[model samples]
Target: MTARSSSAHVAEVEGVRVDTRHWIGGRRVASDATFTDVSPIDEQSIADVHAGGQAEVDAAVTAAREAFGTWAAMPVKQRADILRAVADGVDARRDDLAMVETRDNGSLLRSHLRGVMPRVAMNFRYFADLAEQISHPIDEIRGHRQRVSYDPAGVVAVITPWNAPLMLATWRIGPALAAGNTVVLKPPEWAPLTASLLADIANDAGLPAGVFNVVQGSGARAGAPLTRHPGINRLSFTGSVPTAGVIAEAAAKNIVPLSFELGGKSALLVLDDADLDLAVTLAVEQFDNAGQVCLGAFRVLVHESLHDEFLQRVLASASALVQGDPRDEATDVSALVSRPHFERVRGFVERALADGARAVLGGGPNDDLGGLYFRPTILVDARPGSEILTEEVFGPVLTVQTFATEEEGIALANDTRFGLAATLVTGDPERAERVSARLNAGTVWVNCFFVRDLGAPFGGNGKSGIGREGGAWSFDFYCDVKNTVFAPHGWHAVEGGGDS
Candidate 1:
């Protein structure tokens, strides 16, 4: 059968009964390990995906190792060229990928965040450009000349989460392979569709066999072994704090370098001088993807001076969002990752409501869409210590707290254990700058909530994450530094022999 550019055009595999499955190597591999992919909107099987236990994981590692020699040794420009092809391939099949991702993980549209495409290209191009930028420069250190160079870390294991699977997965993949390191990626089981699509793109782009391999499975069976693999060099993970800890511990057992991007309950400040309209827009936008984002602004701290007005406006905006099927072109909101997640958010809201917090706008789930839909609920008077404030709810629920003074606002914002990203809607330059610095996050925005470019270096400061993964330095996490010392002049052996 011929390859198709759209999901609509994908020729149905003969006798293939599942809509969801794993892509290992160049095809939909049947594995002894298997799990069913269920839609979050309704707890129903979309397809049976490959569980990809140790055998498949070992095959991926071996394949990556075999490909490393040639792929890593290729000229940086050549690598960049292949990445460009990958970007184009992703674009060519944008709709197809978007449908798969939306169906599996509930993404808005594949094309909207097709930043995955350009990001991979840019990531590769950035490192490709670095090849020329990094030159042997004679440096005199205390009267001695020295030189330094960067080398690949050999084999890397990338463990990505469900949210933003394509984008985040590429963020890890592009840089790792570009840095001359081979990679074995384990995408979240919830979103194997995007992983499968990316595997297809890699093959279409003609990536060297095994330069980048993806094994489909969960964190326990697939993730633990890869992280603890004796042959693996580094482990890069994006998930929650608890999981990150487990991966870190396992990597530590092997003495492998680990890059972890953990949980976050980021804060969004609605300063007194802020424009209410702008704040409302950003607040709603931040809740996109149902606030299942690592850098999501969960706590909306409004200055008490504007507390009444801000709460009223935000509640209005939240009420206006139509939560339903993600496939609907007009649906502004979609269901959470699963029924348990929806139930979990409901529980958090219930606890907050009982703790003197009042839900002025939305509190209950919309059972109309089969209970998978939860209204974009907002709570007022939620204290800092509440689970809604500290823990990563990772749902559409937003906790609104009031601050009487800028000091209170700053304190409340910094109260969380996370330092991923923060948003402040303020017109005052002085105040914005102050808030930006004291926010304690890796990235901050004034009048902006959740937007970033492909070139930005992004990571967390505290338990949020370790190391960044967006710019040329992104490769640093996946690479090793090597230095070679050589004699500037030929040895005096001949002259000494003559003298002797």
Candidate 2:
């Protein structure tokens, strides 16, 4: 690694060059205190990243505040054009971004290249077009006409998680920038490099200085200050419930508006009429990304008639998942993000096993593969409302429970505190609609897992999240909606300049 004062600090990792510095006011800012970023694949040091503190947060927030007026005042079409250009930049460097994220976060390279990377570009493009096309109709009440408009909220602070760094960050950033709000993003410390790369892309796409700034470091140092800063007009965060609580407190201090997508213990209900193959596949999908996903179906409730068959098929599919090097194209799964995270996940399963839950498939680490790789685990016989059954383990461990009746199934699925997402595998359309409406989840999928459309509102119902984000909903959060009322035809203003 080499530090250049006038430019970004550059480092070479596995034949790829990456910028590792805080991006503020269209400049790369470095600090004397740095943290070593390690790759989860082999536990090797990848790069030295600048550890941001109050000073960096102050600089980023100040930049965003200064840029907010001009950015917000600019024509929406012009802003959309810039967003489209950023999308193009992301598309042009898709392969590189995928590779970097894979190494940084230990997610499969194939997933990033095929799914995550493309969706990242799509987020910008989708928001750009929506920003231009979305319109609010004028309303008439009594003798007055009112035109509702959304004005950009000044300085938005976007704090994202490491599970799906680039994609999730852009999910918030695209809409924020499209709404004409300048943003100061505090990327997760575990997978911060891709965010730096994104800043570079934004700058190259001609995003004006101070419009999009990044401050990279630990939550206590960078995130806390950014959340609590008075300059921040709006905030969005995606992480654990405990972390969200901390952020909620910080936001409350300044009364900064916040949108959160927090933890989930989402359930996948296997109805008696469901296709056994499809139900099995959906159950196995929970192990994708090593079960780090907040929307993952960690709790599986199966109808008694299909329980035996579903369990058998799910085990076979999970066992077939290839766990190895994340860089390999054929690899389906990889190591957890870090040693601490691995330990945390491992501890969850250990405690469950001790509590008498039966692990028919996997119970602990996959020693044969070694190094932070945990086997896809399936637990059963856990008592109702037990720790493993109710809490979010956030690992490759899933528990299977049986429900004898339709009412029982719905009750079991809605039992968790989290309502981020749920999946119902059923062939009957009427039953799908009936059961889906009753399930307490923000998103309900019928015979599908993780199918998302940018136009639809996305969020949680309970502890899963605070507010929705997507399409106009995103605009609503990033902007202050105001209605301008007009005097009816032939109406006259008062002599004091007040409307009659």
Candidate 3:
């Protein structure tokens, strides 16, 4: 894929060259405070992003509110057609968007171009088709017919994370729009470029002004305001648990319904009868995207009978992974999003080692790369209660534990505060089914990992999240259901008149 020329689209604000800006009310807008975008690969300046705050958040929410009525009034087919056009627009700009995201978030260009971008467009199309099939269901009772219809939830605030900016943002935006809701999206400050580009694409696809808006800045400044804004009818946030708590409190003030997809320390279980090679492959591959994925298998629980063998294979596979610049197509792992994140991940490994956990593979930073690079680390003999095993590292570090019985494995996997996702690898289909039924996670993959169906519900339980997302779940979250009861024209109401 060819990289788009970024210089040609540079914007000038007050005689200063700016590469990023906010999209509010269908146009690019600048902000008084600016944040520099630095590439994680080399720590070089990539652009100056607009640092939007309360004022900008207010403007965005106001715009979405103003456009909600008109957007919600649009016919379903027309809305579907517009969503298809948006999907087409994203497909056309796939390469450019992939490059922007890779530069902004340190994702491998190959994966972004092949996996993330296509999935982004697919999400819009999926919701579009679902929207076309929606209908109001009616139930008839004694002298009345109740028609249950869905309506847009008015203005929605979508706060997305940096890990997979565009993909996750569209996960909220597509369904919200398809359900006739106007949206104000706040992309994490660490990766905001593609979100602005998405705003441009929506405008080109004929999305009405104020129907969709993008605000770029820190979570405390932009995201907090969006959550608290009274104009917003619903909130959908994907981030850490602490942040979700803060948002939950703010949304409660106005009784705004919310969908929270919070943090996870998901486990990948390798049963005694499982195919060891496939299990190792799946475990090591969890480090894809530098383990920033929320569903990543950070904790691996292997049957004691297979633990030693699995550990050797895991160590070898992880050691063979190539870590270099993200732009390098062959690179398996890229730098963390920033230096602070890198230090945090390194600290996890350092503390784990100091606590008597053995580093079976990588345990240090790659200083030679001159960037925020942490080696793909694997830890064994980590105490089950240790921070590395219990908390979310959110980096390319996998902690291994051993379980003697199938019951113990299941218990170990479900011991975390998060129940976002889990994986079970086993040759016995009966065991897979039985153990999957016992797992507390929202999604349990049997003999595989990251296998998703766009039509199925996706979310978490426990501290991981509040409600489901994806397909019909998205529609439900962004919409309000109203029941309209119509009584027979000449009917008279009487207490206890109806006969069973």
Best by lDDT: 2
In the range 375-492, model 3's lDDT, one tens digit per residue, is 8888889976889988899999998999999989999999998999999999998988899999999998888888888889999999999999877777788999888878777877
Per-residue lDDT, model 2, residue 7, is 32
lDDT of 1 by residue, 378-447 (tens): 7778765877788888888788888898888999899978999899989999888877888899889788
Error of 2 at 335 (Å): 0.8
The sequence of per-residue lDDT tens digits that candidate 2 reaches over residues 235-260 is 99999899989999989989999999
lDDT of 1 at 52: 76
Candidate 3 to truth, TM: 0.95
Better of 1 and 2 by TM-score: 2
Tell me the lDDT of model 3 at 429.
88
Off by over 4 Å in 3: 1-19, 492-500
Better of 1 and 3 by TM-score: 3
lDDT of 3 at 79: 90
Q: Model 1: how far is 281 from its true place, Å? A: 1.6
Q: Mark the regions of model 1 whose C-alpha exceeds 4 Å error after superposition.
A: 1-28, 110-138, 142-144, 484-487, 491-500
What TM-score goes with each of the models? 0.90, 0.96, 0.95
**Poorest stretch of ten by lDDT in candidate 2:** 1-10
Q: How far out, in Å, is residue 53 in model 1?
A: 1.2
